[model samples]
Target: MEETAGDHQACRERPAASHLSWAGDGPETRSGLALGHHRPGETPMSHHLRTLAVVGSACAISATLLSSAASAAPGSPGPARVDAAGDATALKRPAWTRLRAEHSKKCVEIPGWSKRQGVRADQWSCVKQANMQWALWLVQAPGAGGVRHHIYAIQNRNSGLCLTVDAKRNGSSVTQRQCRNKKYGDNYTKQLFWYTPDNRFFSQYAKGKCLDIAGASKRNRALTTVWKCSYAKNQRFKNIK
Candidate 1:
């Protein structure tokens, strides 16, 4: 016999005695607590212990997060970052200033020429000495002849003396000639020369000043003038200091 519609509705609204049990037959309802929701088999005491464990774990995680945040907070000095900046600053310092200071006092010493006057050749040494001025020479050469030969003059402003290179008639001596600017055949060329504190000679005898030599002279007796650099045999000034 089929149950009447009114009877089914009444049964749904008013569940049977078995349905009144705390643990129903279905797995979700069978456990005193919701079955799959958490640990279904745990007793009331076990549930409390599990809750306590979760709370402790959450507290530990929160503490770690807070510590990390504090370490990164504003005004907190990060040691590695500070070290990196210091290293960078050290690297940025100019190296040449120290080099100049270190070698400033050392005078170049050479043979033959007098330290009192005339050009002398010498090597750079690390020592503070008055004679150091002679060790340094100003080099000059003309433009076109930079390849063939160099012209240079050694001058000591403090000593108020200058030296030049001149080829003697016999090549017998590397004469320390008086420094002067002499005119050549044209306005474009002139005499050019330089000297070393160690009595070394560097020079250019080409036909014109560095500027005028561009297209002027063809060969011998061309005028030459002093310039900053010349690759000529004469222009190479040995850096003693």
Candidate 2:
């Protein structure tokens, strides 16, 4: 298909619901230390001074604890902490990968995947080509209401064009189009997709569509399009390498 700027129209907006929940050790508790009582010969002034010192130390410790808690508030995108093993287990981000169709035994490919726009994405015999690999980038969709959904842009490794839904309609053929760099006013919604826990590639723009192998053919060059998502094997794919 010929490349055209008009083929890349604005994407529709959709709300997201996924959020990263923070899991860590519970709030630290400090034990109350018993202050020693004044002895029989101890002066009243000295005992009073000792008591005051203990109270001041306790107050300082309490302030420090509060400060730490505030910094580690839930949903805060702060740096990951090291565990007891001294290993820094940072938040795991999705990586670039090649998607292999479970039933067809093919990989998603963007034919003539270049810097041009309007190239259609399809499936081909599993190969080690770079154009068949995709870089999965997570982006927040519009109208998410503060929830972080698993929206992503499947960008071609060689061409840099993102996997997009042509014409932004249901049953639209999935294709490779220009990547949206801006935050808004682009067809980002059409380009965004999410992988379900069951490994189905769901389209963010299409309300209930998923990336599917047309006709469920198990042959090479079988087309990839958007269709009503189902639990069929043709609709399932997994990232490899």
Task: Please identify model 2 stretches exceeding 4 Å from their true place.
Answer: 1-94, 113-115, 141-145, 168-170, 182-186
- For every model shown, the clashing-pair count is 28, 3
Task: Report the error of model 1 at residue 132, Å.
Answer: 3.1
lDDT top scorer? 2
lDDT of 1 at 166: 33
In the range 1-241, model 1's lDDT, one tens digit per residue, is 3334454444346422211222343355422433223454657666556545544554456556656766767541121111112223123221111001111222332223343433433334334443334322223323543634343333332332333323322221222223333322211111233333333333344222111111123332222223333333222233433
Q: How many residue pairs of model 2 clash at the backbone?
A: 3
Poorly placed runs, candidate 1 (over 4 Å): 1-130, 134-151, 166-178, 183-201, 205-241
lDDT of 2 at 23: 36
TM-score of each: 0.25, 0.56
* Worst window of 10 by summed lDDT in candidate 2: 79-88
Measured with C-alpha atoms, the lDDT of residue 108 in candidate 2 is: 90
